[model samples]
Target: MTVGVEEEFVLVDPRSGVTAAEAPRVLELLKDERGVVAEFLRYQVESVTGICRSLSEVRADLTRLRGRVAEAAQDAGCVALATGVAPFARVSPVTDDPRYRRLADRFPRLIGEAGTCGCHVHVGVPSRAVGVRVLARLRPWLATVLAISANSPYVDGLDSGWASARYPLWSRWPTVRPPSAWHGTAGYDAAVDGAIRGGKAIDARSVHFHARLSPLHPTVEVRIADVCLDVDDAVLLAGLVRGLVGTALAEERRGVPLPHVPDVLVERSLRAAARHGLGGPGVDVLTGVPVAHERLAEDLLVHVRPALRATGDLEDVRSGLWALTARGGGSERQRALRAGAGTPADFVARLAATTRGGDLERKAAQ
Candidate 1:
């Protein structure tokens, strides 16, 4: 199976939360690279890797890609951040592009102020039927993943009181929501057709479920994670996703029926995850009872261990999750920095310090 990742990063002014339209300039510098591209907004750029089938290869590719992009952005007098939302962004700061402009015009209220960064993992599936099955099985687990990886804590100059404000804000779009449980390909196709015919989305391709069958690729796209600041974190996330997809496929082959989770319960779990992150308690999708985040993560890891071992990624996943627990999520680190500095500028400067390329570190020391 082939594994790929796409990360949307924000180009921020080092001192202010203002968006920078520097992706074109940065892309020019990285155009010679293997897997870097511009995102929908000028302030955001995406980095994808060539097909990777192992953890080490994925790690190397992601590390190199991030280093290159960080170098380019620094040269342009801007710094990039991997967060769900910038703490001080103003909605008016989004660049004036045709697509953005159209979105703003059409959904004046929602689109005018919805710039958020996220990471997406795409793992190839053999067929649409497998993709649908993967989506069905993965739906209940989405909020668990989100809770463990909730890195967005602030937005638009205020504390959003949610670990991932991006999830809630982005979910406001009429067409975007957690996918409904589908029995099979027929049910999946019917759902897509309804969404398109009702004018809720542009086409079958635009169904923005938390996890979905990628219309443009022969993969299942996991779209629930916030952009992680550390390349190691991102790589680990990619590994976990690959393992999960592999596990789902195995279950299908074993004739295991996908678990059923009610839509309301899914929404509630998502909210609980966003609000508490892994810091406090969250609702358990399986039990419908509240439980500590750490316990839930441990349970999840056990369930997916076979897939992890099969891919030779169990160690990476275990180590990465351990590191996160120790260092805390990006939101926790950002909060600590903010408390110490007492200003957003200082917080951003600290972020820039952490995001600076390792290659640049050597040059700067001279």
Candidate 2:
């Protein structure tokens, strides 16, 4: 299966670490660059990779896009931050677009505070029916993925006590929730239409289930993860997502009935992941018992091992998980950096360094 990634980054003033509404300028600088585009908020930008058949392709494309955005942000007198939320910034004004303006008017408070960023992975499926089934199969494991990618720890200059504080904050949108085990494409379409008809979702675009069949492509889009701090981490996620989709597709072909994990359990598991990140305890999707996140990760790997091996990603995903756990995930790394920082500026400095893989230092040394 082919995959792609979409990462959202916030532009921050270099000195103060405040989110800067300079996306227009940064985007202007990136006019020659492909895959980089403005987001709903003027302080944010998004990078979309073309469909990739291998992890290396995803890495190369993501690295290039991140580097371009980082350089563009520097030219605009800001830094492109990969964290899920601005650590210390007030709500940014919405971008000047008719659709965004309509959203702003319809959900003023929600739109005002909805600057959360995320990393979305799309893995191609055979059809919308297959994609919907993949989404249903993916629900039990999405929380673990969220825990693995928890990058946002600080919110509004204070510790939010949630690893991916962006998760709950983003959940303020009416349609943002776990995907349901729909019958097939018709069921999924009906659910989306119902949300729109009931005024919960603005349109098909607003059907923000954590995992959903992509409206624009023949893929299942997984939006459960926060924007990772490193390109390698992002690629790791893409590999795992592809593995999951591949496993689900195989099961579907073998006549596997849709799994029946309870919604309440799924929500609880998600909440735990958001609250504690990877180092904390997680609920087992099957048993509803508290398990360490490491154990959860191990179980997930086991479940997808066949697919991983088939895709030649078994060792890479294994090593990546080990590295992530050893260094602590992005949330823990941010906390550690914040602990050593004498000021918010210093924290942002350290974060900005890792966000772009020390590219700035390399450029400066040159």
Candidate 3:
């Protein structure tokens, strides 16, 4: 399967989570590696890898890309952080980028205040029919994936209490939640057209559903997960996504009817997942009973196990999940670091160190 990865990273002062739109300056220092760096917000830069079929290749590409970016940022006296939201990001700190300016002008209330980052994984679908089918099957499991990858807990200098505040915040935009069930490509195109004509959106590209058929690519894009700081976490999440899509495709081949879930149940389940992480209460979307989030996660994992094994990624996926649960996601780690350091600035400094790729090398060496 062809896979592509896009990671959004925050540019911040080494000691502060505040926005540092110094990406342009840092890019200048790197001699402009085309296809490697793309502009996100003024305060963020995104790195994308070309299509690769193997997990090992993906990991190698990402490690090289991240290391290069970190070195460039260090040369420019800045650091890049991989997280859903920087704790100190403020609307006023957004850099003056033309696209961002347009966004601010168009959706003043929403775009002006938005500063969350995320990772989007796009796996190629052989046809548009497959794309829609994969998206439909993917919708029900969005919340579980979001919970497993909850990395953004603090926003605007305080804990947002939600394991991934980026989820709730990103859901504010119109057409930005989970995808609705559409029967085929024609139905999907019609829906996009109607939304545009009815002023619900500007164009087909604006249909920013959490898991949607990519207008620009021949793939279904999974956009709900946070930008994980640990490279292992990011890789594991991508592997799971690949497995899920593969399973959905297999089910489609078997002529399995796509399950119809109530929208209200999906929303409720997502909210609970965001609030509790894996340690808190999670609602069973099928039954609406409150249960442990970890149990729900396990059930979801079971459904995707065959796919995981087929992809030869079950071990890595399980190991990565264990690492997150044991050491805590980015939020918990940030909280622990803050408690020990006694200041947000200190915590951010530690985060910068962690993201520099040096920490992983040190761990391996030890």
Candidate 4:
């Protein structure tokens, strides 16, 4: 299956460690660049990769696009940061778009704090009906995915004691939640229609389920992960999500029954994953019992092992998970930097360096 990735980033002034409202300038510089676009917040920009079939292709595309955005940020007098929420709060004005303006007017407080960024993965499916089936299969494992990709630990310059504080902030939206067990395309369409009719959402785009059929593409979009600090982690997420989808598709073909898990239990697991990431306690979706985060992650790997091997991503995903365990997720890394750097300025400087391809640059230099 072909996969595509969309990553959002925050623009900040490296010296002051505060967000910068320079995305318009950055977007102008990247006008000639394909798949680079503005986000709802003026201080954020997004990079999208065209359909890719391999992890290597995902890496190459992200590396090149990240490099381009970093260079443009320099030209725009800002630095691009791959983070879920700005370490310090400074809400940028909404982008000059009518839709965003309407959203701001309709929900001032929610949109004001909606500066968070996330990584979205789109995996191609044959049809909406098949996509709905894949979404059902994906529901139980979404928490594990969130845990693995947790990158937001700070809110308003303070440690929130959650691996991904962005989850709660983003969940403030009325329609944002874990998707329910949908029967088919008809059921999915009904839910979307209901959300709009009931005024819970402005439109289909506003139906922000964790996983859904992409309104603009023939794929299943998994919208659970925080925007990763490292390009490798982003690639790892893409590989694992694609594997999960592949496994689901195989099961569908074989007429395997869908696993039964309560939505409330799944939602609880998501919250636990957000609070602890991979280093603390989490709820297992299958058993609905408390389990170590590491164990949940292992279960995900085991569940998708066949698909990973089939797609030749087994080794890369395994090694990537090992690296995460050794070095930690973005939350752990951010906390370590905060403790060692001694100042917010130093912390943001180091963060900006990483977001701007410092590690990739070092590898190339060596």
Residue-by-residue lDDT tens digits, candidate 3, 1-366: 778888888877766667777877877776667545645366677888778787777787777778888888878777787778877755444456565565566566786447788888989899998898788898778877787777888888888888888888888877787778888888888878887787656667666788888888998899888887767777877887888898899899999999888889888888887777766788887787888877877787788889888878788877777776777766676666567665656667666656655665344223
Lowest lDDT 10-mer window, candidate 4?
A: 357-366
Q: How close is each model in CA RMSD to the real structure?
A: 2.7, 1.9, 2.5, 2.0
Error of 1 at 12 (Å): 1.1
TM-score for each candidate, following the candidate numbering:
0.92, 0.97, 0.92, 0.97
Instruction: Tell me the tens digit of each residue's lDDT in model 2 across 282-353.
Output: 999888999999889888889999999999999989989888888898899888878877877777777877
Kindly state the number of residue pairs that clash in model 1: 0
Per-structure clash totals for the candidates: 0, 0, 0, 0
Clashes of 2: 0
lDDT per model vs. reference: 0.78, 0.89, 0.76, 0.88
lDDT for each residue of candidate 4 in 234-315, tens digit (9 for 90 to 100): 9889989999999999999999998898988998999999999988899988888899988888888898999999989999
| Candidate 4 accuracy as TM-score | 0.97
Pick out the ten consecutive residues of candidate 3 with the lowest summed lDDT: 357-366
Once model 2 is optimally superposed onto the true structure by TM-score, how far is the C-alpha of residue 115 displaced, in angstroms?
0.4
Which residue pairs in model 3 clash with each other? none
Weakest ten-residue segment in model 2 by summed lDDT: 357-366
Kindly report which residue stretches of model 2 are placed more than 4 angstroms away from their true locations once superposed: 358-366
